[model samples]
Target chain A: MTENGFDTSCGASSGTRILVIEDEDTITEFLKTGLKYEGYQVTIAKDGVTGVDCAREMEPDLIILDIMLPDKDGFEVCRRIRRRDSDVPILMLTAKKEISDKVKGLDVGADDYLTKPFSFEELLARIRALLRRSGRAVDSTELRVVDIVLNTETREVYKGGKKVSLTPTEFSLLELFMRHPRRVFTRETLLNRIWGYDYAGDTNIVDVHISHLRDKIGDKPPCLIRTHYGVGYAFYPGEGK
Target chain B: MWKKLSLRTRLTILYAGLLALLLTILGVTFFIDTRNLLIENTASHIRATAKPIIEHWLYGENLSSQAIEGTKKKPDSKYLKKISRQLARDLTSRNVVAIVLDKNGKVIANGKVLEEEPAPVSPNPFYYRRAFSGENEVTYILSTDNKNVLVLLIPLRSAPGSDHVLGVVQLSSPLTPVERILYRHGLTLAVGTLITLILGTALGLLLISSALSELRHMIATCQSITEGRMDQRVHLPQRSDEVGQLAQAFNRMVERLEASFSAQRRFVASAAHELRTPLTALRGSLEVLMRGAQDDPATVAHLCHGMYREVLRLSKLCEELLDLAKLEISENVQKEKVVLKEFVNEFEEQARVLSQEREISILEGPSVSLKADPNMLKQILFDLLQNALQHTGRNGRIALGWKLGDNGVDIWVEDNGHGILAEDLPHIFEPFYQGKKVSECGEHHKGSGLGLTLVKAMVEAHGGSIEVRSEVNRGTTFLIKLPFE
Candidate 1:
C-alpha cells in the first residue's frame, strides 16, 4: 500500500485521460496536480462553455464535473458530452449535498457523484467505480485481499485454497469489499449497491450476513472484514497480522 | 394618529355630533315659524273684533248724545256707561275688553277688564295721535300678569263723515290661546329632539359595534401571533364591503408574517444542522489522528485529507450563507429587454467551459424576446443548467432551449440523466433540504442547500415561475417561465 492507502500495484491506465470542469482556479490547479500525481493525463476547463468544447475535442476517458460554473453548469456539460460520446464515465462534484442535486447530476448522464471537501481516496474510488461500471477500467475480473480471493467471472470464492460457498447477495457484498479493500463502506451503501436501488429490506440483513460469512471463513486465524465501530465495515488485507 | 381611538368609539361620537347639529337646526326653524304665526293671528283677531263694535257705538242713536258731549272732551261716566253697556251687548266676544276714552285721553268707560291692572286709559301719545287722525292702530302689550295682550285704538267720528273727532274706542284682547299653542308646540319639539337624539345614539353605537367586529378579530389574531401562535387566522365575514376588505387585508398580512417567522426558524435550524455535519466530520478525523493513526503515514494522509475536506465544506457553507443574505436583500432586479437568440448565443460562449468533459448542447427554439433583469435572468439559467449538469453523467445529453408563448418565454434545461426520486420533488427548492439521493450516491458533503432556494426566489422576484418534470432513470427538465411584462 502506498502512503495514500492505495494499492500502487493496480495502477491506472498509462494513458488514462481525465477532464476537469471547474470555475475556481485554485481547485482546478489542485485537481490537475493531484490527478496527474496519480498517473492520469489531466485537462482543465475554466468555465462551462469551454469545458463542453474540450470534451468534444479531447474525448477524454473520464470527466469530473463541478456543479457550479461561471457560464454553463456541470450538468449541461455532462449532457453535451453525452450527446457526442456515449461511453465515457462522468463523476459529478458539487459543494452542495442536496439529494436533488445528486439526482439531477445522475439524471444528466453522470455515472457517479462526489461532493466537495472529498478525500482523494474517495474521489479515486468513485472514479474507479464509474470506470469499472462503464467497462473501461483495467481492473481485473478476480478480486483478492490476503488469502480470500473472489472470481467475478465464475462467481467463485476461495479461502486459503479452500472453496467457500456464498449466496448471490453475499458474493456481491464480498466482491465490493474486496475491490475497495481497506475502504470503509456504510451499511446503507452496501444495501444500495448489493440489494439494488429499491431495496427496502432491513439494514441488519447486512450485519446478519456479515457475521455468518465471518463465522464460515474462520475468524480465528485472520480477521478479513473489520468493523469500523459505529461507522461501517472495511475489508482489511491483514498485512499487519 | 387617530388609530389610538377604538373604531366603535370614534364612529359613535361622529354620528352623535352630526345628529345633534341636525336636530338643533330643525328645532330653531320650527320655533321661529310657530312664534311668527301665533303673533300675526292674534293681531288680526283683535282688529276684526274692534271694527264692528266701533261702528255700532258711533252710529247708534244712544251714543250720539254721548258723542256730542264728548265733543266737549269732558268725562261723562253715566252716559259712557250706558254706551259701553250697549256696545258690550252688541258684541259678545270672549277675552276682549272695551274701554271708552275722552278726546283728552281720560277713561270714560271700563268694561270687562280681564286683569286687575285696568287697561291703561292714558294711551301712548304716539298711538293717540294715530287714533286722532282717524287711523286705527294695534299694539302688543306684555302685561304684568304674563299675558300677551293685543290693543286696537280707533277714533270716534260724529256720523262717519264728521270732521270733529269724538272720543276714541280702545279694544284689548288677552293672547292666552296663542301662547298656549306655542307652549304646546315648544314642549313637543323639545321632547321629540330628546327622543331622536337618544335613538340616534343607540343605533349609531349598534352599527359601530357591528362594523368594528372585524377590527376586534384582527386585534385578537395579532395578539395570538405575538404570543407565538403563528397559525392563528381571523375568520372573516363573507361581505365585500370596506370592513370585509380590511379583514381580508389584515388576514393576508398576518399570514405573510407567520410564514416569514416560520421560514426564519427553519433557516436557523437547517443552517445549524448543515454546519454541524461538517464540524462533526472534522472532529472525528482529528480524534482518529490523535489516537495514534498519525504513526502510519497512509492513515495520517487519509485523516488529514478528510479533515481538510470538512474545513472546506465549512468555509463554503459560510460563503453560501452570505450569498443567501445578499440575494434576499437585493430588492430590485436590473431589467432589460433580453433577446433570446442573442442571449443564448452569449451564454453558449460562456457555458462551453462548464461542460469540459460532458456533452452539452444548446437548441435554438424561437427568437423570443423578454423584458427581465439581465443578471437575475442569467442566474436563473445558470442555476437550472448547473442543476442538470450535476445529475447527468458522461454520454448523457442536456439540452437548453426556449419556447415563445403568448404569456411569456419558456426557457428549459433538459437532461437525460438520473432523475430525482418522487419523494424529493416537492422539497427540492426548500433551503437546506438534503435529499436521500445524496446519501444514496454516498456523497459525504453537501452545499449550503440554498442553490435551488435562491433560484426560486430570484425567478419569483422577476415575476416568473419554475417547474420540474422528472422520471426515475429517464431524465429531468427544469422549465422556467419568465413573463415579458
Candidate 2:
C-alpha cells in the first residue's frame, strides 16, 4: 500500500507487481531488497492464507512464494493462485534442495524455483526471466553475444547472420550463457538454470548440450564459449583475458 | 599299516630288530662252539688215562714173556691174576676198561666184567693196524648202539729185543659222561639265549612304544588342524626332542592364522558400518519428506528438495562405497602406461565443470608419463578434486599439479580455501570421517564423507600412497605418489 510499491528502483511500469509470500522476516527482507534493486515491485505475505489473499487482490505479475508458511503451505497457495490466475508466473523458494520438492512446486503451478541460501543475483535473474516469459514485462525479443544471436520468442538462433540449427536444450543453454556472458557457470548451475531444478541426470546433459552448442556455432577462431579447467564453462567473445 | 605308525616308532622298531638279530646269531655260535669243546675234552681225558698203563707194560715194568707162559699153569696163573687184579682196580677208577687180547684176537684178561656186558665193536682191522703201527688214535662216531662217542686206542709193547708179543691191553671208557657234560652245556646255552632274546625284545618294545606315542600325538594334532579346527593344538610331553620342537612350530603357525582372521573380520565389519550409516540417514530424510506436510506447497517443495539432495548424497555415497570395496577386494589392479598430461587435462576439465562456482586451475608440465591403472588413478584424482571443491567456498581457487619424482610420479591437489584442521588431517582418509574444519564449509559442502576414503583405497590398491599437508585457514595439499613401471 506504500507509494512506489516495496523499494523497487529499476523503474518497472505500473501493474508490474511481485508478490513475496514468506514467513521468515529476514528472507522476506532480503528478497524485498534484491527484487527492488532489480526494479520489481514486491508485496509481502507473512503466511500462506495471507499470501493467497494478496495474490487474489493484487493479481501480481509474478509470485515469489516460500514453501514453508504458517497457515497454508506455499504449494496450496500456489494451487489456489493458479485457480484464479493461470498466466501469472510463480517462483518457488524452498529451503530443501530436493527434486521432489521441485516437482511438487511445479505441480502446483510454480514456473521456477530457487533454493534457500541462494545468491540474490541468481534469484533476481530467475525472476526476471520468468516474468519475461509470462509476458508480464516488456518483451525483449532477442538475446545476443557478439556475432551470435538468439531470439527467444521465435526460437531461432544465428551466428554472424548464418542460420544455425539448435536443439531446444542447446538453445536454452546458449540463451542462459549468453544472458550472462563472461560469467563462469558450473555444470550444476547450468543444469538447474536450463533443465529446470528437478533435472536428475548425470549432469553430463549439460556437457552434451554444450558440445552441441559448439558444433552449431561452427569451428572458428575465438569460440564464443570457453572451458575453464578445474572450474566451469564461460562465454567469451574474443580471446579470453 | 606302517604309515599309521609315526616315523619315530618305525625307526626305533627297525633298530631294535637289528640288535635282536645280532644277539641271536652270537648266542647260536657260542652254544655250538662250547658243545664241540666239551666233546674234545672228553676224548683227551680218555687218551691220557690209557696212555700211562700201556707204556708201563711195554717198558717192562710188569711181568714179561715168561710170566705170560707161566700164566697157562694154575699157580702161575694165580700169581698173574693177583697182579692183573691190582692193575684192573687202578684202571677202573680212571674210567678205563681194559682187556688182554691173544694173537687170535680172543679176550684173555678182561677187567671189570660187571652186571652189564660191554657192547662189542665191529672187528674192523683199522684199530689193530693202528695199534701195530704204534700210533695212538682218537675218533668220534655213532657206534652200533647209535650213541655218540669218542674212542681212543693204545698198543701194548714188550721189552726191547724180546721176540715175544704181549697181549693187547686196551683201556675202554664209556663216552656217556662226556655226552652228559655236553648236554648240560647245551642246556645252559639255550637258556641263556632265550633269556637274552626275551630281555632284548622287551627293552626294544618299551623304547619304541615311548617314541611312537609322541609321534602319534603329533599326527593326531595335524589331522585335527586339517579338519578345520585351527584352534586345536598339540600337547607334547615337555621333552627336548625333535617331535616337541615340531609341535611348537606348528602352534606358532596356527597363531599367525588366527591373528590374520581376526584382522580380516574387523576390517569387514568396519567397512559395513561405514556404508550403512549414510544409507540409513538418507532413507530417514526421504521418509520424512514423503509423509509430512503435504498440504503446504512451499514446505513440501522444500522437504522434497531436501530429500532429493539427500538422495544425491546417498547415490554418491553408494558409488564411493562400491569403489572402496572394489579396491579392497582387487588384489592387483590392471596397469597401463598413461600419458599423464592427457589424463590430467581430462581430469581438470571434468573437475572444472563440477566446481564451476569456484576458481580452480591445473598447473603442471606437459605430457608426463607413468605406468598405473588408468581407472584407479583417475578415481584418485576425482576424489581429491571433489573433496577440494566441497571444502573450497565460492570464488576460492584450487590448484592441481604434478611433477616427476625419483621412482614414480608425484601429483598434488591443493586449495587456497579454508584448510583442514591439524588435528583432523590424520584421520581424513578414515571412512565417514568429516574433519571439523571441513564441517563448517556449508550444508551442501558436507559430502558423503567417503571421498578421501575412496581416494586412499584407490591409491593403495594401485600400490601407491597419498600424503596430506594442511594448515588451518591456510590451505591443504594432497600429494600422491604413484610408482612407475
Candidate 3:
C-alpha cells in the first residue's frame, strides 16, 4: 500500500485501511475522524448486517466490531466475516463485563476485544499491533534519534544502551516525536496525534505522559525531548542527564 | 404416638379397630342369647318329662288319700319310702335324681343316677317347705359332677286339680345337651369374628394405599422440584381429590417462580445494555472535545451539550433503578385523603405542559374520595402520560378519565396515535422492554425503558392494579385501579 503519493507517519504512504462496525453514532464519528487523521482510511458500518456485507466486498486490513448491534450481534458478524476471510484480524468491543469473556467462549475467533470506556490511545495501539501482526502495516521497524534507539516491531525503547519502560501512551508519544526529530508539534497536535480522541477532563494528559517518558529515559531536565514555550515538544538529543 | 404415625397407618387402625370393636360386641350378645335359649329349652324338656311321672305313679300312692283330707293326714313316711325308690329307678334313663319328702318335712327316701354320695338333701329344704304349702317349687343347681341340674317339686294330690296336705316328689335333671349346644354356638361366634377382622384389616390396608398413592407421587415430584427441575409436574389426569388439587397448585407455583426468575435475568441483561449506550456516548463526546474540538468554540459547545444530554439520560436511568429497588422494600404507603376530581385537575395542569403539541382533554366524573399516597399516584400519571406522548404522533388526541366503581376508582389514559404492536403489548411493562423500534420513534423518543415498569410498581404499591389495551396502528389505553380503603 506504499504506492500512494501521500506521506504518512511511516515516511511513506503506508496506506492501511480499517473497518469499524458500530451501532452508536457518537462512537462511529469519533473513530472515523480520529482514524482518518492517523493516515488510515476508515470505513464505517452502522450495523452488523451492513458490516458483514462490507467485509465480503472491501476486504479491509483490520476490523473493529461492537458486540451489541441492531440486526445482528458482534459475534455473529465476526463469524460471518471469518467464514469468508479467516486471516483478517477482528477486534471486538463489548459493553458488558460477561460478554467480553464470551467473545472467546463463543469461539468466533476474534483476534482481540476491548471493553467499553477504553481510551482512544489504547485502541490505536491495539489496532497498530493487529495490523503489524497481519503484515498489513509496512511501517519502518526501528528508529534512532541520536543515542536513543526504539524498535517499533518489538516495542522496545533504549536510551544510552539501557532499556527504558514506557506506558503505551508514553511509547506512542515518544515514537511520534522521534519519527520527526527537530520538528516542533503544538499541544493540540500532540494530543490529537498520539492520544487520538482519548477522553479526559484534565486537558494535560499529553504533558503528564511526556514528563513520565522523560523521567523513565532519564531526560527529566527536559534536554532530550525539549518543550517549546507556546508550541508543544521536539526531540533534541543531548547529554541532558 | 398416634399423631406420630403415618396417615395411612392411622387410617388403617381406625378402620380395623372400629370393625374389631363392633364384632366383639355382636359376638358377646349372640353368645349370651344362645346360652339363655339353650337353658330355657333344657328346662322345658325336663318339665315335660317329669309331669307324667308325678301325676301317675307318685300321686296315686300314699299322697292321694291326703287330698280333700287336710293336713292332719300326713302321708305315712313308710309308704313314701316304698314308691320313692321305684320313682328314682324310673328316671335312671332320664338322667334325673329323685327324692321323696314326707308331709312333716322329713326326707324319707332318695335314690340313684345322682351324685356319687347319696344327695345331701337338707332335712327341711326350701322345696320341702314350699311343697307342704301345696305349691310346686322349681330351681336349678350345678351338680357335683359339673352338670346343670333342674330341681322340680310336686304336691301329691288326692284327686285331679286338688290342693291337699300330701307328701312331695322332687326330680333333678342334668342339662349336658344344652351345654354342648352353647359351646358349639360360642365357637362359631368367636371364629366368625376372627375371620371378619382379618379380612377387614387386609381390605382396609388396600383401600388406604390406593387412596394415598397420589399423595406419595406428589411428594416425589416435590423432591424433584427441590433439586431444581423447574419443569417437573405431578402429571395427574384431572383427579379432583385433595392431592390432585395440591399437585395443580404446586405446578402453578413452580411455573410462576421460573417465569419471574427468568424475567429478572432478562431485566439485568437489558439494563446493562441500556446503561452502556449512554455511557459510550458520554465518553465519545468528551473525548472528541478534549482531543481537538476544544480549540473551536462551535464544536466545543456542541459536544458539551451532547455530553450533558447523555449524562441526563444516565442519571434518569439510575433514578429509575433506585425507584425499582425502593418499590420492592416499601410496603408502607403514605395515606392521604384525595378527591378524584381535584386530583385530576392538579394532574391535568401538569399533563398540559407535558403534552406539548399533543391535544389533551379530561373526562368529567364523580368526585370520588379515597385514601392513597399522593406522590406515587402522581408518578403513575406522569409515567403513563409520558409513555403516551412518546408513542403518539404530533397533535395526537389524549384523554384522561376517571370512574367511581363499586370496588375502587378507575383512572384511565388513552392516546390516539401509533399504538403498540400486539406482540409487544404483553411485555411493554417488563423492565427495560422497548415497545417499538427506537429508530421509528425518533432520537429523543428513545426511553430509559423503565417508565411503565415504575408506573406498574407504584400502582401495585397503592394496593391497586394496572392494565393496558392497544391496537397496532389505532390507539392505546392504560387503566389504573386504586381500590378504596
Candidate 4:
C-alpha cells in the first residue's frame, strides 16, 4: 500500500488505463498527474468532440469525463463511448452541484458522477470503485484489508480466519467498504449503494446495520470499520506495517 | 373664494341662484301686470263718471232752456253752481276729483264743489283746448305731491255721431291705492321667492352631499393605500353611475398593486433563503479548515473542495437572480418567425451530445412556423431537455420534437424517466422550490432551483404556454404550445 492508496499486492499492479475528457487545463493536468502517480496509464482530451474520438481510439479501461466541453459536453462523450464499449466504466465530473447533473450523467451511461472542485482522494476512490464494479481493477472476486476478508462471488465474510455470517444489506455494506478501504462513505452514500437509489427510509438504519455487522464480525480493540465523527465511516486497517 | 368652495357647496349655490332668478322674473311680471290693471280700472271709473255729467250738460236732459243755454255757453257763475251740484253725485269714489270746462276755455263746474267755500277754481286752460279736438283724452301724471294721478278729458257733442265740438269735461284721480295694492303683492312675491330659495338651497346641499359621498369614500381608500394597506377598497354602490365605476376601477387597481407587492416580497424572501444555504456551506467549510484541518493534506483538500463548490453555488444563484430580474423587467417581446424544423435541428447536436449513452433523438414534425422570441424560446427548450435528461436512465428513450396542432404548434421533450410526484407538479415552477424528494436527498439535486421557473417565465414571455403530464416510473412529457403569429 502506497500513499496514493495503491495496493501493490493486488494482482494487477500497473497499466490500468484511464481516459480523461476535460476542457479545463488545470483539471486535466491534476487528473493526469494524480492518476499517473497512482500507477495507472492516463490519456487526456481537451474537448467533447475530441474526447469521443479519443475514447474510441484509446479504449481505456476507465474514463473520467467533464460534463461541460467546448464542441460537445461530457454526456455526449459518455454516450458515444458507451455505444461501442458498454462494459467500460465512465465517471462524470460536472461543475454543477446538481443531482440532476449526476442523474443525467448516469442516465447517459456514466457509472457515477463527481461534482467539480472534488478532492483528489475522493476522485480516486470513485474511479477505483467504478473500475472495480466493471471488474477491470480488482481481478479477484475477493477483497481483503488486514485480517478482514470479503468474497464477492461467495458473498462470504471472514474475520481473523473465522467465518462470519452477514445479512444481505450488511454484506453489501461491508463489501462496498472493503472494495475501497480507507475511503470515507457517508451514511447517505452507503444507503444509496446498499439499499437502492430510491430508498426513502431513515438514515439510522445504516448505523444500526453497521453496528450489527461490527458485532457479528467480532472487531478487536482497533475496530476494522472506523467511525469518523462529524463525517462518516471508513474501513481503516491498522497503522502497523 | 368661490373657487375654493367644495363641489357640493358650489352645486348647491348654483341651484339656489337659478331658482331665485326664475322667481324674480315671475314676480316682476305679475306685479307690473296687476298694477297696470288696477291703474286702468281707476282711470276708466273716473272717465265713466265724467261721460254722464258731460252728456247731461250738453243735452240739457232735465234743464229749462235758460239753464241749458247758460250751461252750453261757458256756464256763468250762477249756472256753473247748478252744473257742479249735478256732477257732485259721481265724485264719491276714492281719490276722485272732477272738473268741467266750457268751449270758451272758462271753468264752469267742479265735482268737489260742495267742499269749496269760493267756487272751486276752474281746471287748467290747456285741458279745455286739448279736449276740444272732437275726441276724448286720458293721461296719467305724477302730481307735485308725489301722488300718481289719472286724468280723463271728454269733448261732448249735442247729439250722437256728431263731430261738432262742445264744452269739455275733465276728471282726475290719485293712483296711491293701486300703488299700495301692487306694493303689497310684490312684497309677498319677494318673500315667497326668498323662502323658495332657502328650501332649494337646502335640497341642493342634500343632493350634492349624497352624490359626492362615493368620491369621499374613494379618497379614504386612497389614504388607506398610501398608509401601506394596499388591500383596502372603496365601498361600492349598486348603481353603475360614474362614481360607482370609478370605485370598481380603483379596487381593481389596488388588487393588482397588492399582488405585485406580494410577489416582490416573496421573491426577496426566497432569494434570501437560497443564499443562506450556500453561505452556510461556505462558513462550515471555512470553520473546519480553520480548526486545524489545514494541517492534514487530505482534509485540507476536501474542505477547500467543498468551499469551492459552495462558491460556485453562490455564483450560480447570482446568475439566476439576475435572470429573474431581467425577466421581470422585460416588458416587450421581440418576435421572429422560427421554423420548427430549424429549431429542432439545433437540438440534434445537443441531443447527440447529451444522449451519448442514452437513446435520444429528435422527431421533427411538419414544417410548422410560429412567431416567438427566439432567445427565450431556446432557453425554454433547453430547460425542459435538461430536466428530461436528469430523470431518464441509461438506454432510456428520450424524444425532442414538435407537432402541428389545431391552433398552433406544440413542441415537446419527453422521456421514459422517473416522473415528478403529483404534489410537486404545481410548485415545480416556483423559484427556490425543488421537488420534495430532491430536497431530502443526501446530495441535493444540484440546481439553482430556478430552472423550471425560468422556463415558465421564458415560455410566457414568448406568448406561449407550457403543460406537463407524467406517470410515476413510466415517463414525463413537457409540451409548449405557441400560437401562430
Runs of candidate 4 exceeding 4 Å displacement: A1-241, B1-184, B207-221, B236-239, B330-333, B347-371, B387-430, B434-446, B459-485
What stretches of model 2 exceed 4 Å from their correct place? A1-241, B1-26, B37-232, B240-242, B293-330, B333-485
What is the per-residue lDDT of model 3 for residues B351-430, given as tens digits with 9 covering 90 to 100? 99989889999997787898999888888898899888887888789999999865999899999877887888899889
Candidate 3 CAPRI level: acceptable
Per residue, candidate 2 scores C-alpha lDDT tens digits across A138-222 of: 5355665556667877999988899998888888777766554565776766765667655787867777778878888884546
Which of 2 and 4 is the better model by lDDT? 4
Q: Once superposed on the true structure, which residue ranges of model 3 sit more than 4 Å away at CA?
A: A1-18, A25-60, A67-226, A230-241, B1-26, B48-239, B245-273, B279-307, B335-337, B366-371, B403-406
lDDT of 3 by residue, A205-229 (tens): 7788888888887776658789887
lDDT of 3 at B421: 77
Residues B318-337 of candidate 4 have per-residue lDDT tens digits of 99899888888974578888
lDDT score at residue A213, model 3, on the 0-100 scale: 87
CAPRI-style quality class for the chain A–B interface of candidate 2:
incorrect
Ranking by TM-score: 3, 1, 4, 2
Which of candidates 1 and 2 is the stronger one according to DockQ?
Answer: 1
Q: What DockQ number belongs to candidate 3?
A: 0.28
True contacts kept of each: 0.00, 0.00, 0.27, 0.00
DockQ winner, 3 or 4 = 3
Name the candidate that leads on DockQ: 3
Please tell me which predicted candidate would have the highest TM-score against the true structure: 3
TM-score of each: 0.55, 0.37, 0.73, 0.51
Q: Candidate 2 residues B1-485, lDDT tens each? A: 99898676677677667866787788778777876777667667766775676455444335454355644322232333445544544555435555555444455566665646343333335665555455545354446565643445444444443334443445555667777776787788778777877787678778767767777887897898788787888787697777778778878988898766765565554555444433433433333322223323565465456556556755776787677677677746888989988888788778878998888787875456878888878877887877777677788788888888768888999987678877887888776665544445533354566678777877877678899998777788999988877
